[model samples]
Target: MAKPGSSGDEQLPSNEERGCEGIRSRLPLTTLELFFVSVIFGMFSITLLCIYITMPSVDQKFLKIPRTVEELRTLTEYVSKYTDSYKPQVLAGFCVTYIFMQTFMIPGTIVMSLLAGSLFGIAEGAALVIFTATAGASSCYFLSKLIGRPLAMWLWPDKLRFFTREVAKRRDYLFNYMLFLRVTPTLPNTFINVCSPIVGVPYLTFLVATMLGLLPATFVTVRAGVALNTLRSFNELYDVKTVGALFVIGFVSIMPAIMSKFQSQDSDRSHSS
Candidate 1:
């Protein structure tokens, strides 16, 4: 029985304070949503661990700093020794590592891609890279759509604006535009993966573009891996000629959209005249 305006009443939080508490406590992802994401992420980790434990001679240093050429070579050698007996585990470990990096937007996928090429040969490696990359990108897309808007807004406000406008402008040719993004180093694949949904790109477009778009780059990285023994520096992976060729391919992918816009303008000019 509190009295009106008594000292006891003064100690109680006001409506405004209660409202502020509610706002502060609210989470972007509800508990259930977070739990679901955690479970999926955990499954990947568990799968990797199971593969590791079953391997007869697990290199504890496997996949440690894949970006380093020496470490990559060592990892390749370590895995090569057991390929005949542990091929499934090797492939599983690679997929888990690659997908985990992609799902959480971690770096070092480049190293994994290179390792794939070096260990598995070019064709198989490229297929694996493309498949895992697409899977990871799709996972990120849905996760971001569910609970990543605020983080994306916070991390990439300006880039978000540019991407949004570009996506809008290229709505008819969205797949080609996405292909351009994937093939070129224009916007990072991670950024595109997490933000594409936020910018209104369809999942199918993202999937198709990612699968086809990654082929050229995957071919290059895997080919570089085939020669991993001779590579002194990681820079050798993407030399001037390789980069120029990629840019050329990227430009060609988007050229149709550009040509369409130009033809549209030409029609408008003729009509005005």
Candidate 2:
């Protein structure tokens, strides 16, 4: 039994509060809409479009990073001989191309990683791959944010839903999940990129997760790169030894998560009792 005045008071909002709520709802729609429109109309979008148009004109197939041990061996020799000549530009082009493919969710990142190793050798290849991949993933994050969720949904429907749900439910342990994804080699790199932003994964988390998450697989592929000519099939990359190691790594990566879940259940039971 409340007084009439109390009922009236509860229903009323202060002038400032009502105004703020109105601004909030409209801002995401109005302001964000304009932001996306700007990107679509602006120089960046135009340049990207132009790049896409001109891209097909280039020798894109030849542009692929090499894969195979013998290819790497020969590439290293060539680089060694021409270190003063073709090193910087070649590496720069490699980085740019790799980043472009990844940012756009192009399907050849695996070959790119192998190419780095095949062309640059283990240490240098891994470094280049990691750097370019991180940059590309970051670019995707911005692109997704700029375009908004609808475009992301169109680009990656199933992944967007799965990632969004996983992130919402296990936000605190997101790093754990990211680690699992990275180690298991389940999803491709581009799938993770296009879908991550739609889920609202924080930029710092995405950056750190991607940077760390991509390393082992990159290394594995890069190592395979050092043997490209010797290998006939991509399957040779994970012939038994590598797969076994990957599983062990995956297990180690997720053990902490299992421990955390168990601890939470124990705490809940204690509280109830």
Q: Indicate which candidate wins on lDDT.
A: 1
Residue 179, model 2, lDDT: 73
Weakest 10 consecutive residues of candidate 2 by summed lDDT:
1-10
> lDDT scores for all predictions?
0.80, 0.65
Show the lowest summed lDDT stretch of 10 residues, model 1. Answer: 1-10
TM-score of each: 0.84, 0.70
Task: Write down the TM-score for model 2.
Answer: 0.70
- Screening candidate 2 with a backbone cut-off below 3 angstroms (N, C-alpha, C), the clashing residue pairs are 68-227, 68-228, 68-229, 69-226, 69-227, 69-228, 69-229, 70-229
Compared with the true structure, model 1 gives a TM-score of 0.84
Q: Candidate 1 — what's its lDDT?
A: 0.80
- What's the true lDDT of residue 80 in model 1? 87
Per-residue lDDT of 176 in model 1: 89
